[model samples]
Target: METNATTNENLNMYEKAENYTKTSLELIKLKTVSATADVLSTLTSRIAVGAVVAFFTLFLNIGLSLWIGKELGEYYYGFFALAVFYLLVAVILHKTQHKLIKTPIGNMIVSSILKESKN
Candidate 1:
């Protein structure tokens, strides 16, 4: 009878562990989808803002460069400045992407999963 009880307890524990594993996997799937959506939304917003800014900036830069090039009699220098501006924008955006990846939402997902498992 004692052996039977021990065997039954072990079976129960095994079932619980299996269920937990399945639940954890499902949670991971959901988190993956959620994270993707979040990143997409962030990128979309940034792109929308960048589109508007870029439109105006492009025209303004063109006018300014032409004026500067005419005054200095060196169009290549004006073009170089434009290139540097674009490179700076790219660098800033790359940093922003890194920061976003390390955000609270990402941390919360892992922390919540750990908290759930502890329970």
Candidate 2:
């Protein structure tokens, strides 16, 4: 009778461990999904805002170029000046892209995930 009771207790312990493991896995999955959704939503909204700003910048630059061209007596010269300015800007960005862009983006993603986990 004592041996049977001991076996039964061990079986119950095993069942409890199994239940705990399953519950832990489910929680992990839920957290992963929540973090992913948070990051994606944040990125989507930023992209939308960026698109609007891009359009505004495009029109503003075009108008400025035309005005500059009128002042210079040739529209193409305005464009050439703008092109040179942008070329310098592009080179600077390329040189510092890892520091300016990649690190910030990586930190943002990590923070988003940590924020979700905390919640």
Candidate 3:
């Protein structure tokens, strides 16, 4: 009778541990899914907005280039001037990209993952 009672207690403990392990795994999965969804949604919205802004900037630049060319007496000259201006800007950005671009993006990803869910 004593052995039987001890065996039963051990079996109950085993069941409880199994339940705890499964529940913990499920919680981790839920957290991972929630974080991933949050990051993807934010990125999707930003990309959409970025695309719209890019189109606007492109058209504006084209118009400005034509105006500049008209003033310079040649269309290609305006484009060449704009190209040189952009080349300078690109060089500046390349020099500071780690500070201005990479760090901010990395921080944003980390913050997004660490952010607590309202639920």
Candidate 4:
């Protein structure tokens, strides 16, 4: 009878240990997944904002091209000027955006905010 009792206690202890291990692993997995999701969300938001800015810039360029064409009396010449201006804007914006993304603190802050919001 005593031996049986001892065996039962040992089995319970093993079961508890197994359960604890599983829970710890699950928690780690959840944290990892959350962190990855936060990173992706932040990056996606940044890209989306960049796209919106680019779109507005393009629209502005088109409007300016039409305005210039009307004022200068030649649509093609005004369009060429607008094209050069648009190229300049694109280059500057691209360089600025690239530098911003490369900054470590930018991602850290963005990811942290996203993670906090998710919680």
Clashes of 2: 0
Tens digit of lDDT per residue, candidate 2, span 1-117?
999999999999999999999999999999999999999999999999999999998998898888888899999888887888899999999999999999999999999999988
What do the candidate models score in CA lDDT, each in turn?
0.78, 0.95, 0.93, 0.82
Q: How far is candidate 4 from the true structure (C-alpha RMSD, Å)?
A: 4.3
lDDT of 3 at 104: 100
Task: Please tell me which predicted candidate would have the highest lDDT against the true structure.
Answer: 2
Please give, for residues 11-118, the per-residue lDDT of candidate 4 as tens digits.
Answer: 999999999999999987887777777777877998899999999988987788888988899877779997787799888878887576557667686668566556
Please count the clashing residue pairs in each candidate, in the order shown: 0, 0, 0, 0
The TM-score values for the models, in the order shown, are 0.51, 0.94, 0.93, 0.59
Mind giving the per-residue lDDT tens digits that candidate 3 earns over 1-119?
Answer: 99999999999999999999999999888989999999999999999999999999899889989999999999988889899999999999999999999999999999998884444
Worst 10 residues of 4 by lDDT: 98-107
Whole-model alpha-carbon lDDT for candidate 4: 0.82
Q: How close is candidate 4 to the true structure, as a TM-score?
A: 0.59
Q: What's the true lDDT of residue 80 in model 2?
A: 84
lDDT of 1 by residue, 61-81 (tens): 998787767777898777777
TM-score of 1: 0.51
Worst 10 residues of 2 by lDDT: 76-85
In model 4, the runs with Cα more than 4 Å from the true position are 1-7, 33-55, 93-98, 104-110, 113-119
lDDT of 4 at 48: 100
Please list all clashing residue pairs in model 1, or write none if there are none.
none
Model 2 lDDT on a 0 to 1 scale: 0.95
